[model samples]
Target: MRLIQINKTYGDKTVLKDVTLDFPIGKVTVLVGPSGSGKSTILRSLNFLVTPESGQYDFNDHQIDFSQSISNKEKLAVRRETGMVFQDYNLFPHKTVLGNIIEGPTQVLKMGKKQAIKVAKELLAKVGLADYGDVYPSELSGGQAQRVAIARALAMKPRYVLLDEPTSALDPELELSVLKVLLQLAHEKQSMVLVTHNMAFAKQIADKIIFVENGEIIYDGDPKKFFSQDNSSKRIKNFIASMTMENLK
Candidate 1:
């Protein structure tokens, strides 16, 4: 996806300001920055969850303006190729793991019930939650819950996966488990945009690291140079310092 001078505002508060960037295809890219720096806003804008005030978004060769009036059907078609996972699992309390994964495909995609269940079972195993399909979300650990969430997103067969603070709500142990799954996914599939504070993981797996500050991208390139000690930008340095301390503590 390509974003050209994307801009967004809420009343007088500008959440994203002329942010321009290209997400390399078939690679895992990381967006790292301070909280409320518009990383999440960029993700939301990509999926049109939040419309931008100005600029163009190019997806699969189609360029669209956020200000243009788009039909719900058109938006839904775009959603089919993009999957989003949030910090919260957002699974239904009343549904079984199996139920949650199959609901969308069977209902929205109009897949047969048996076919959806067949697909769900395979995804469950792939995510390492093969035995948890019959269980409720309440019975699973945070990591397991998040895995199911990821699997549910995958069940839709999206081309691009967008993650927002995926491990923030988990404990250390659970967080590690979830992070491992994310790494596995990144290695297994080539397309994903991860918005996270995990610098270590970004350094390890990201093809490119994007640094956003105060609703704009200050830098976008190799992780090593972006986080280097010689980098004298106060905003970038402060963000790296704070994340390092948080991880250390």
Candidate 2:
């Protein structure tokens, strides 16, 4: 998936300016930066959750242009290939875990209950929540709930799973369980775009890291070099210094 010449503006505030970057297939790209730098906006624009003022997006054979008006069929097609996991679990309060997971498959994809439930059960087990399918969202711990959310996203069998600060809502103690599941996904080579404040986890999982500030991409390259990376901007270097695990520890 690739985004080119992306631009966005909110009144006087220009959120994204001529942003272009490639998300290599089956690889994880982690976005990091100070709050309000528009990292999340970049993620949101990928599926047109927040459309860009102008840009071109290409994911496999599907290409979209924000420069022209887009139809609902185009929008639905983009959404069909992607899934998003939020900081808050975003599970339906009235629904059981299995109900939440199967909703997308049964309703949107027109899949039958037997197949959806069978797939849901396998995904639940993958997230280490096989037995919790019968339980309500309120009954699970923060980590467990987030795991269910991950499972819900995977139930769609999307090509890419976009996460916005998925671990941010969990307590420090509960973060590991969620991270463990993510690491497993990493091992299985799932493609993902993640916006996060957790530098340690970013360092661990990111194949590439993009640092943004003031609504522009300042750095876009390898994660291995990002920690010790010395780029053109001193301000970005300082920001990296502050967020690196060495400084945190």
Candidate 3:
């Protein structure tokens, strides 16, 4: 999937300025930047949750011109190809873990209920929640809930999984659990686009890294070189130092 010359704004504030990005298949692309740097906006745009006012979105056979009014069918079609996991987990409070995982497959994909449940159970096991299918969201811990959310996203069998601060809400111990699942996905070569503040996890899993600041990309290249500050600007160096310091605190 690719975004070309994308621009987005809210009133006088520009959020994304002519941003162009590519998400390659079977690779993990990590977006890292300071707060309010438009990383989340870029991630959301991947799933069509936040539409840019202008630019082109190319995914599979679909080429969307954001300058024109997009039809609901077009939006849904693009959305079905990507799964989004947000910081909040966003699980249905009234639904059990099994129900949440099967919701997309049974509703959107139109899979049979039995088949959906079967698939959901397998995904739950993949995320280390096989026994929690009958548990409700309210009963699970932060990490457990996030794992279920991951399973729910994977249940759709999306070509790419988009995650925005998936571990930001949890404590250090709980955060490790979510990161473990993500690392496993990386090893399995599941394509993912992630917006995160966790630099260590980013360095460990990213096949490519894009650094954004003030809604503009500062760096987009090799993670090893980017993290090593090789040929990087003073600004990039300072940002990394600051993030490292923050992590230490």
Candidate 4:
């Protein structure tokens, strides 16, 4: 999937300025930046959740022109290929874990209920939540709920899994659980685009890193170089130092 010359704004404030990015297949691409730097918007635009004012988005056989009015069908098609996991788990409060995971498969994919449930079970196990299928979102801890959310996203079998700060809402211990699932996915070569604040985790899992600041990309290359104190830009060095300090606190 690729975005070319993308530009987005809200009134007088420009969020993304001619941003072009590529998400390689079977690789984990991590987006790291300070707050309000347009990382989340870039993540959301993958599934058309946050439309840009102008640009081209190419995914598989679909090429979307953001300057034109997008049809609902076009939007749905893009979303079908991309699974989004937000900062918040966003699970259905009234639904059980099994129900939440199977909803998209059974409804949108038109899989049989039994088949959807079967696939959901496998995904739940993959995320280390095999026994929690009958449990409701309200009953699960922060980490458990996020795992279920991951399972729900996986059950769709999307081509690219887009995560917007998936572990940000949890404490460090709980964050580790979610990170483990993500690391496992990376090991299995699942293509993904992630927006995250965890520099340590980003260095560990990223195949490519894109650093954004003030809605512009400051760096887009090797994670090793991005994290290297001596090699990175002064701005990036300061940013990393600040983030590291914040993490220590």
- The lDDT per prediction is 0.87, 0.90, 0.92, 0.92
Residue by residue across 9-94, what tens digits does model 2's lDDT show? 99999999999989877899999999999999999988889999898999878888889898998888878778999999999989
Which pairs, if any, clash in model 2? none
lDDT of 4 by residue, 1-249 (tens): 999999999999999999999899999999999999999999988988899999999999999999999999999898887988988899999999999999999889999999999999999898888899999999999999999988888888999999999999999999999999999999999999999999899999999999998899889999989888677488888888888895366
Instruction: Give residue 142's error in model 4 in angstroms.
Output: 0.6
What would the TM-score be for candidate 1 when compared with the true structure?
A: 0.94
What would the C-alpha RMSD of candidate 2 be, to one decimal place?
1.7
The C-alpha local distance difference test score for the whole of candidate 2 amounts to: 0.90
What tens digits encode model 3's per-residue C-alpha lDDT throughout 165-222? Answer: 9999999999999999999999999999999988888989999999998889889888
C-alpha TM-score for every candidate: 0.94, 0.95, 0.97, 0.97
Q: On a 0 to 100 scale, what is the lDDT of residue 245 in model 3?
A: 89
Looking at model 3, report the run of 10 residues with the lowest lDDT sum: 229-238
The count of backbone overlaps in candidate 4 is 0
Q: Tell me the lDDT of candidate 3.
A: 0.92
Pairs in clash, predicted candidate 3: none
1 versus 4: better TM-score goes to: 4
